[model samples]
Target: MPNAANESSEGTGFQPGDGVVEEASELQEASSADRTPEEEFLAQMLAASGATNLKEAGLYDPAEVAAEEERIEEEMSPEERQAKAEHDALAAAFSMIRERSNEGKLTTPGTWAAAGIVPDHLIPVDFSDLAFDEIIAAQAASAAAKKVAEEAAQAVVADADADAVSADSSVEDVAASDSKADEAADENAPSVDEGDSLDSEIETPEWKLDDIKVLEGKQTYLYSSDYMTDTYAHWAFLAEEGDDALTLVDNAREESRLYPRPMLAASLSSKPYYWNAEQIEQAWQAVQESGSYPDINTCEASNGERYFYSTDYLSDAQAKALAEWYSVERYMNV
Candidate 1:
């Protein structure tokens, strides 16, 4: 007989290393060949998913995956990162869709179409169930409300016009009454008498100096410079003569620097008594003869008031005459 093992192998058609192991080896080789295409398809899917690398898709070892993830993150442009973020958001939304679909809360497009509830983008929305009758009722109510408001406004305007007419009538009546009252008052007023008028008898108050008296034993009068030297002194002497003749003399003396002639002239002339022409002439002559007559320029009266004139032309006799004329007392106390 041939070798028993060889006889059995020949019966089974088995050769050395040509059994199931060889077949398995061949299958592994074919799988290896298919693996390249499968890997390429997976890479394309991952690219479409916006995964940066196999590591992001959980296809690499932990250490290698970490390195790959870092490399992918580093290598990605800003735009790529943005795109990846959008893809992630879309994936999350899809995941939510899937979860809701699984939970029966959301229906698929096929289901929606079968139920006659297609998306508005794909089909015109049907509003058959809408309550159009209620909308019509609301519109009618709005129109009725607007009409009521207009009617109310018209009523208010009519009322306001009536009130304005009444007010205007009242105002006209008031004005007429006031006019009548003014006319009545004018008719009832008393007439004034021309002869007995207050203006005829009322004497104007004169600004005469008071409490003026000659100091004894002093030929020349003395007075406070500041008190009598201003424009008011001239005004006082020019005012109407009064009982205050001495006061007028004092004022003039003070204003004219104690010039005796000007002081007396101002005092006598300011007296209110009506002197005759002869008396006036006599008074004037006395003033001319006064020894203390002020110089011409300083002696001239200004604003109708006598002031001490300043001049070199005044003679001694004229000065003496002026002083004597002014010295006569116009009023004497008994």
Candidate 2:
């Protein structure tokens, strides 16, 4: 006689894996019945969004959403496909930037482009500490990076336009077009002449500034790096070492403390720069002669140690007292 299990299986016409499928179906039903408020809301949203599987709609299921999106995109025309992809890329890039800005982590901007949001060929542009301050020369440097992203987006449009050019298009006409493009590029390109000022090319960052405004208009948003960069780059002339020194000094000055020359010297003389005392002095002298940062100056302690400060941010007497403490008194306490 056959076993009771064999008889039951035969009576139901059950196949392998059929039990698992039925169990899954029952569990899904049970989950639907027991949905929490957020899950129920997600299910309703997925239903309204025309998702094929409302049960798969949740914060944890991006792969499913992407698969659904890819399926919908497959039905669009080539032009529609390209436009949608580009739009989504820009949306992702800007959204990530805005969110990071709120959290104050927007220091290395090239990471924004490198995070797979931008086209693959342009990922190498993410290596900058862009501050975008009109108050400093780095604003022009910042624009240089922004320009690269702009050019990449524009290149896509240019390629499409090139495809539309008539096969019989004349050489002279193309040359004339090329010449005009070159002229426009030359006119807008940022100047980087040694010892020259970039004040002309500067535009007020996407927020208010304490000093000068390069471009005249209202800014609607923040770059999250603004708060941190403002203190560091406000007096920068686009020189990296000098700007970093300013950052160290300004941070100390804020708390009525003086930044030590030994610390500043050690930081600058290390690794890639290896800037010596003479170079540091020459750089400072250049800054002084330029008079762009009249408020910035140095003080010496009784021990002959030097300290930096900005008159705009610190009082002369207060800075002198702190210079002594940083040079001598702090060591005694230690």
Best by lDDT: 2
**How many angstroms is residue 133 displaced in model 2 relative to the true structure, after the best TM-score fit?**
20
Q: For each candidate, what is the lDDT?
A: 0.38, 0.48
Best by TM-score: 2
Q: Please, what are the lDDT tens digits per residue for candidate 2 over residues 152-205?
A: 557655654554463335887777666655665555454566113433344434
Looking at model 2, which ten-residue stretch has the lowest summed lDDT?
Answer: 212-221
Instruction: State each model's C-alpha RMSD to the native.
Output: 52.1, 21.0
Task: Kindly report the root-mean-square deviation of model 1 from the true structure over all alpha carbons.
Answer: 52.1
lDDT digits (tens) for residues 1-334 of candidate 1: 1122222233444223322333333333454445566555655645566655443444433454455445555556665554444334323333433343333233222332354433232331221111123223444555555565566456555554444444434777767655655554444332366323433343322211121111112121211222433333333333322323333334444534544344434444432334444544454454456644444322432223333322343344554445444443222222
Return the TM-score for each candidate structure.
0.15, 0.38
